[model samples]
Target: MRRHRYAKIVATVGPATNTPEMLKALFLAGVDTFRLNFSHGVQADHAKVHASIRALEKEVGRPIGILQDLQGPKIRVGTVRDGRLDLTSGERVRFVLEGSEGGKDAIPLHHPEIFAAVVPGQDLLIDDGRVRVRVVGVEAAVIEAEVITAGVISNRKGVNLPGTLLDLSPLTEKDRADLAFGLELGVDWVALSFVQKPSDVIEARGLIGDKAGIMTKVEKPQALDRIEDIIRLSDAVMVARGDLGVEIPHEDVPARQKELIRACRLAVKPVIVATQMLDSMVNAPAPTRAEASDVATAIYDGADAVMLSAESATGRYPVEAVSMMDRIIRSVEGHKLYHSIIAALEPGEEETPPHAVATATATLAEAIHATAIVAYTESGTTAARVARKRPAVPILALTPNVDTSRRLSLLWGAHSVRTDDVDSYEEMTAKACHHAQEEGFAKPNDIVVTAAGIPFHTTGNTNNIRLIQI
Candidate 1:
């Protein structure tokens, strides 16, 4: 099937919409991509869903992308004795790492690394910030906190330390195993959640090899600190506002989200703005006006995709939510400024080394009135950077890996093709021209711009630009 012209809709899969019929209905409802959250589904269940999606793809006679979202190292309080706790304002509470053998007033924290990082005066948010506590004292295995605000605390409540940097690796054992399973299942994309540094992307890539594209979830404050490096390493990015709002000040999330989106655009990497875009539609048939505007703003900001979590996964109005998001994207793209905003966000000469080369190729394509710009990239970064320029002509990205090809389908104006990896820049350019001709993207005597690296050492090292005729 032809890809969506504007922003794509990524609908998550869940219990409410896990069957084959519901999956087919969602695809027909305009879901461009399916996100399988590994956090909730087991491997066996995912295998069943994968089979169903493949069957649907054959039925529709089109390629559909499957994104496996890995649940990274999530910190949560251990089991509570009574299954709940109620704290009043100013009440003193103690959290202990007692190896899951704690009493009624205490909860076990299984993560010793997080326990070691706790200090006095640090804030700990529980249950997605439904309750708040201020650490007042610390002992060997226990930390005492004074209730800053009182609320109901339930079992397995999520914990977030905004300013406190936990001494933990981004990937846990569970994430690594999940990633292996996803790659074995031939997932197109593997989204790493709670990405804090560039190393996280590197680790995930090492584990998944080239079997799947690695997408970093930017929801931690530390991720923003290392945004450029993370963007450079990641194939795509997801603006996960749910935990991001908890990690940073609530009022700052909006501006931060915009900044991340713009940064990804400059890098030419496909970015997805996710979490609660149409949350009310989970129960209600329609979203609030503010939610509509929110989806529109993401498209206006040049995001490659907008995501629906619960709205489509377990919502009563799953199809309607996807349809509404599609409409919102179309309306926003109709604005003249939308194109201009994308063009203006392109990386300039001073941005980064690879970005400079990508900009030059895009500029050459425009100046020569090229019919197509072909980028030979193994990592898909160069293709993404060129697509970010939003050149009027189409972009043909040639890759040897199927995962790279599928991932690039999310980018604007990019059509990916799988071919043999080239060892030299000359061969890369020649193959680009050949494919552009064969694919009918470029006609005889039509100008095409080709870009690649000198020795072609790495997939992301785009350093050469040449203008050629098909």
Candidate 2:
């Protein structure tokens, strides 16, 4: 089934939506990509989910992308004596380096980088800022902090050091193992969490090589300082606003998000706006009015895709969440102002072959009122270039490689179909027209625009465009 909207939907797969039948239902409800969160599942669990996804893909005859999210270096407090402790406001606590059973006086701090990086007056947010603490003193192997907000301090609660750049690599030992497993599974995308600099992206790229596309999760404030370089190095970027909201001022998130989307558009990389789009749907059958508006706003801001986390992974009503998100996207895309908003954000004149062809193809499509823009791509670059233009017409990308087709499914306004490699321009055009009609994008005598490389089956050679009628 074809999705009605241009922007894609990424759904996380977990226990609630891991079954083949549930996955099929989600795909039918308009989930273009499945994210396997490495933070929670083991290799066996992910393997099962991956197999089920492939099975559903074969049954539906559509390429569904799989993204493996690597859990980066996550610092946490060590174990407590009673598994939990209650700390009151203004209480002084000592975070010690030595591993010891935490008591009312002191707790174990495993990461040495925290002691080395954090200084007096820096805020330490725990459990997503539920308990805030200010560093009062720092010694060689100890950190003295006073609790600003009173809350229970549980065992292994997450630690967030705001405004402190830790001297630690994004990839931990666990992440390397998880990446190897995900690569062996042939996942289409690898999302590296907590990317702080361009070097982090380069490191991930080195490890991933050409096996899978690297998508950097921009949650750290430090990433914004060098976002241009990060976007240039990454194959894609995720606007991960969950922890990002914790680190930075909440009011600044919207502007930062817009900046990231614009940067990715200019770089011609697929960008995903993620986290809490439909959070209320995790338990309830419908989303809040504000949540609906939030999803629509992301679409209006020209996001390539909107993602669902717990709402689709462990939510009680996974299918309902997908359905609601689908409805919201469709309704927003149908509005007349949607076209105006997207057209306003189109990229300006760029002196690149792909950019020239992409812009011209979009203009010609709108001028001739073509039914669709058919792109024959091998690396998905041409499709991405056209998507960057944000054309009003639909994009049908035909690829011989299944991986390329699946990856393109996450792109905005691009519908990917796997087909054989054509040997000539006429054959390519004929195949495009045939698939366009078969895919319900056109009918007999309907005009369509075809774009491909003159030298058949070559990548990055989208030098020809033709107008043909089916």
Which of the numbered candidates is closest to the native, going by highest TM-score? 2
lDDT tens digits, residues 1-470, model 2?
77778999999998899999999999999999999999997899999999999999999988999999999998899998889889899989889899778786778889999999989999999988898999999999989999999998899999888788888788999999999999999999999998889999888888999899999999988888899999999999999999999899899999998888988998999999999999999999999999999999999989999999999999999999998888989999999899999888765666888678977887899889999999889999888888888888999999998889999989999999999999987788789989999998999999988777778878887788889999
lDDT string for model 1 (1-470, tens) is: 44445567899999888899999988888776799999997999998998899899779754578999988889998877677777889988888877664543476777777678878988999988878999998888888889997997777889998877777777788887887788888899989988878887887788877677788999888888889999989878999999999878889988987898888876667899999999999999999999999998887777888999999888999989988888788777777777777677654444677878988898888888898888888867888778777776678888886666767767766777878988875676679778998777877888899978767757678788888876
Question: Which residue pairs does candidate 2 place in steric collision?
Answer: none
- How many clashes show up in model 1? 1
Q: Where in model 2 is the C-alpha error above 4 Å?
A: none
The whole-model lDDT of each prediction reads 0.82, 0.91
TM-score of each: 0.85, 0.97
Error of 1 at 340 (Å): 2.2
Where's the lowest-lDDT run of ten residues in candidate 2?
Answer: 346-355
